[model samples]
Target: MPNLNNVSSPSLWQRIWQGFLTTVGTKQFFRIFAPWVKWLAILASIFLVIGSVWGLAFAPPDYLQGNSYRIIFIHVPAASLAISIYFALAVLGVIFLVWKIKTASLVAQALAPLGFLLCVISLITGSIWAKPTWGTYWVWDARLTSMLILAFLYAGVMALFAAFEHTANRGKAAAILSIVGAVNLPIIKYSVQWWNTLHQGSTFTLTAAPKMSADMWMPLLLMVVGSYLLVATLAIYRTNTLILYRDQGKAWVKEYIRGQNK
Candidate 1:
């Protein structure tokens, strides 16, 4: 068998670390905040925070749902992103499974936790939103039910990936399930729309919109942007850590380890 532990004579580790950092290190992160990605996340977050706080605190209560509507800002973004993450995870999962591309699997692993976080936030916020709106904290409503399924699926994905003592089967299994879950998200999203259901219509859709004025929506949009950046930036950072873990004993790792010694 070929020697897998192929450490080079001197500085191979330094070369690899530089290459790894090339895609998304601190410099790239600054670009996202100030130059690239339009810094849209930060800008949008400002508007969102202002809009959410003002609307939640000082805006007039809905004549119908009353103060409970305040939860929409939190619930809507969480719900939207939870679904979005499934699609992303599925695509990345498929790539990882097909290519066995080390980077892709690392990314999928990094993103699993974020997906779960969004799902949990969506569930908790949905429950809170429902309490005043539906007169109960728990419901078998279509939207709630589907969203719960999403959260569980995310957990399953995470669990599969983290079953690393069984690494070979774990990666393959997680990737397949993530892709399968992605296919189900749209089905879940549209279930309420297609059938008569207790869950409310979508907030930003043409037929259904927020029952609020412009002052109310501006911040909600901002929050959505901020949430996306937060997830993405965190994912990238986590992926870096995972790559290091996976590659720790490589020639590159040894060379870099030596460089730090000098």
Candidate 2:
């Protein structure tokens, strides 16, 4: 008896939008989906191992830089992830500030150290590569300087968050700091072009073919994708632990603990 002909099925984009809506607002979606994060971590680990091996061994040496260029596998991905994670942190800050989502703040808090670590890795790797490429260990180059500032920004966020004892106060202060820190991200991205920096121009872009040969760029791409996955895995793992800490007293968490104990 139902008018089936008039009932239109949801489009693919509509389903995706609905799913995204469901995942925000309340923390329930994250709580329910947290267990799957470990599987993602496992998968990311596989990708990282494969990509690292392919890059360090199988990929061809650069025509100019030779083996020194191999460090690109690590440095490029780390730098990219460092900036991407900060953007994610800023977005999370906005979410917490606007929506009063405690989980968003907690996730951003957890992300700070990871982002800092990646930024540090990027800087260190860049320095190591520079010794051979640029004849110097360090320089006050625009890109390098901006990236260093980004690392300090990450540290500032962490320190500012810890400085406040109250949860709400800490969240508010950190969120504002994070949003403000986002201004540095673009500065980092465009620094090489904006200023006559020692750093090289971008090797890859979204629209054009890679400047390098396929044999060289393919492994780099794999490394980039793997690093993104690795970052996601780390974020999800940290978020899960933070959620447990924040909700340890809640009934669902209690039930989860009991279930784990069993």
Q: What is the TM-score of each candidate against the true structure?
A: 0.76, 0.89
Candidate 1 residues 197-232, lDDT tens each?
778777675576665676666666666766776676
Error of 2 at 12 (Å): 13
Off by over 4 Å in 2: 1-22, 25-27
RMSD of each: 9.0, 4.0
Tens digits of per-residue lDDT, candidate 2, 84-165, equal 8899889999988887767788778778898999999999999999999999999999999999999999998999878874
Report lDDT (CA) for all predictions.
0.73, 0.86
Best model per lDDT: 2
* TM-score for predicted model 1 compared with the true structure: 0.76
Instruction: Estimate the lDDT of model 1.
Output: 0.73
- Give me candidate 2's TM-score against the actual structure: 0.89
